[model samples]
Target: MVPAPGPRTGARPRRRAGGRGRGRLADGHAAVLQERPCWGSLEDDALFALFRKTEPKVQEIAPGHDPLGDLGPRGQCRIQGLDDDRVQWQVEFAVHQLDGLRGQDDGRWPNEFLSPAMVPLGGGLNGMVSENRAWVALPPSCLGRPGEFDGPTVVDASVGNKDVELGGERGERDRTALARAVVRVANGTLRQLGCKDSLADPGKLPPVSRTTPTQMDALCGIKGLKAPDAERESLRRTRVTSGQGGPVRTCDLTHSGRPWSTSVRFMTVEDPQLAKIFSMAAMTGGPRIKGTKGYGTLTPSRAVYERTCRTGRAVFLVEQRQSDRGYTLPRELLPAYAESEAGRLGCGPVEMKMPAGS
Candidate 1:
């Protein structure tokens, strides 16, 4: 059989040796088997599918090896959170010994007397809080662990000199004086942990207020106060119940010469709680009663709601009886009503009339 012949002159071949067969057709090339577009032309979803085909299901990098390093001399490392979302991690460093001085008392000689001797160089100190606690940042490398020094080191380090200058009156460093330095260290450490400056001064920072009237105009134009739905429900529930009672009246008028006086004779259904709720309402809404600042301790047997009508001269009482022994008004009702003028303006169920003469 005759082998298939190559394409005619000026016609490109169908397959290439190395390249993937996904390329775009050149303009006006209507030749056999139209060429597919290059992968770059594919949409994002197609690219993801291509990726999944070429990658392994579970390739491991540095598998079976420990990821963390040894903790330094202090056996401590800074702990930081992974993100603003509150994940925590611990980091560790290598441990090594300090290089100089054999004995603890080696540094005892006065600066003016003995020549300096070599001091042991040691690994830096590591400071840490509890395992899960958050850390602000790491201390400087020099301060982390002191290095060994040779013979009467001239003690001319500017770092040490600065520390001494800023030291407190007690001849030792005062923490308050080091506030700026501490902040610098903390900022550096936080940067290493991959946080933006915004996270550093979060809630404590003051809000940026509108400076121009135009900037605030949008907010100011929003109309109407938001009322809680619960408050509306409570107001609706405070309407006086039918067949329960009539409006209360009093005989002792301030027009006459008597201290404000009104009496409520509670029915068997009325209890201490109901009496208290109404008594509180009267005190808050009505004129101040005699001998009390609007507030009155209820003698449940005597009255439910009592208030001074004309200054301290006359008292009017709204008496009520609970529908059942267990049905006294809730204690919270008074405060609930007082919270809104709409609430306090309306009265609750009442169940009695003031007896004639009393």
Candidate 2:
């Protein structure tokens, strides 16, 4: 597919094969895609379908542009889990990018802007945002499990497939395991941008906050965080029988819908399973845990989507309650982000307002 031009042009677009060449189609895209050892595509057409599709009049923001600038109250975030017979693992990731341009030598343009991106290592689309159909629709094959899933989660990674020694501790084990996965993915994404680089030790990274089910059910007419259809029927039933005081609780779930959604695919070659991982998301959408009311989905506005597609900027996510949306920024990265030109625009401390008619 041919790429239309957007933003500034000092460096020629690099190929996925990793070299400075006139931006051309089918270069590294094939090799880079092949480099991903897991997940087979139905066909080449399927591989490139998402890459070539585009939205009408999409905003043409570049990768270096900051997505946080126009972020909504509850900055969105997501976690992913995958396990094959030989492995079990989880990683948390988000779809945000750094703000603004960079010198040819900056990490954002590492190797002197020769490669399309220093991090993510794929998708050399011309534009960075929604207009960048190629980057947004990156084939599932390009994303591989960064490490061995030898254990149910990294918390148990060193244990390497041992049975959970404790019977009732599975919930705690799952929570911690999911928490660390985000750190690993966050560090991986941070390698490209100099700003907000991950700490040498990933263990220190914080786990994203998850939403409770009751809290999720309370709201009415929120965006992506709608109650499952069955639950909605239950709520209707409660309201009908009990009147305003019905047993049904009222809550509002508001998601930015910016980053879209995330999927988890796990495989194990040792004893059992094998594969790899989409959706447009305001924030990185995460895993599905039982008993949890909210799945941490978001419905970001068009502005937020454009920002995320353009930059792929922020590497991590922070999920908070709709009332606490403005505080969604991860505390660890808060300083660097605040120092950024966009952060300085007073974007911080954004507030999430619940809808009326509960």
Candidate 3:
């Protein structure tokens, strides 16, 4: 009874010019094309084809909502309109990385998608924060049994003083390894999602995008540093220290075969999660913090001073590299992700706490 579906065109079906269904002309008589029933035996086919075409367009335009009625009309958009090829490629790459498809032979489409999306996705803050926390909490199962860090080792120093050593060959190696691991996980995850052009040789990928100094200041939650006022003056005095009794010191240390003058310090915190987050943030953002020949030599000057002054315990022999640019996890978000084993572990409103006495 019903006619066969309309001829299958290679191109998907699209919406009618005016709106749903064909339009009639202004004349008293229906348009010539009106005889061609908009709802015909092939109507279902046409509608399906139209859906195929329009859905993608909708997704491209708005990525926060469903294109089809199946997902319901949330009034939000669900498409991403990626115009720039570079950005498109980067998004693909980052997507591939997140999909866990690194080192796979299935091309690199996932990686390409993810690479560009990083910028628009809050400068990879979401991913970076998530991954760093994961590393601190879970580490890698392949790392083998945990060894007891009694003392005289970098890990030991890190655990004991809650400080990190970011100098020498070992430090560079550890950082490179961690970075590579992150990249691998990101790429590998994306590969599983059918991205073909994501991975194109590590050397070819763009250099790790650097966050602007302004962005860093924003993340630090410091307001009006550039403004002139008594608060600003007080901040200036608090941040700077002079010859004999300055709060910060620039000391030379070798990192990744290069010498760097890094500022080091110690921060006392009660929460272990906060401590882990601070360590991971510093290692990933500030500088490499492992594989150093003299890692054991690092120490926290303030902690030692405090212990000596308060408890009269002469524990000042340990010297470690601590940085001024460390963070403490916000107390508020702790409850939200406390139950999550591997995702979204509570971190919010991170505070830049001063080391002992700023």
Best by TM-score: 2
> Per-residue CA lDDT of candidate 3, range 1-358, in tens?
0011221333332222223343343432211222111112112222222122221111111111223322111111111112221111000111101111121211121111111111111122122111111111112222223322110000000011112233355443333333333334333332332334232212211122221222112211223212122112112211111122111111111122111221211122112221221222222222222311100111123111111112111111111233343322211111111112111112222222222211
lDDT of 1 by residue, 241-283 (tens): 1121111111111111211111111111121111222433334
**For every model shown, what is its TM-score relative to the native structure?**
0.14, 0.20, 0.19
**Candidate 2 runs further than 4 Å off:** 1-94, 97-168, 199-358
Span of ten consecutive residues with least summed lDDT in model 2: 264-273
**Model 3 accuracy (lDDT, Cα):** 0.20
Cα lDDT for residue 42, model 1?
A: 19
As a whole number from 0 to 100, the lDDT of residue 93 in candidate 3 is: 13
The reply for model 3, stretches above 4 Å from the true place, is 1-165, 200-227, 232-358
- Look at candidate 1 and tell me the lDDT of residue 255: 15
- Rate residue 269 of model 2 by lDDT: 10
Model 2 vs. true fold: TM: 0.20
lDDT of each: 0.21, 0.21, 0.20
lDDT of 2 by residue, 51-90 (tens): 2221101011122323333310111121111122121232
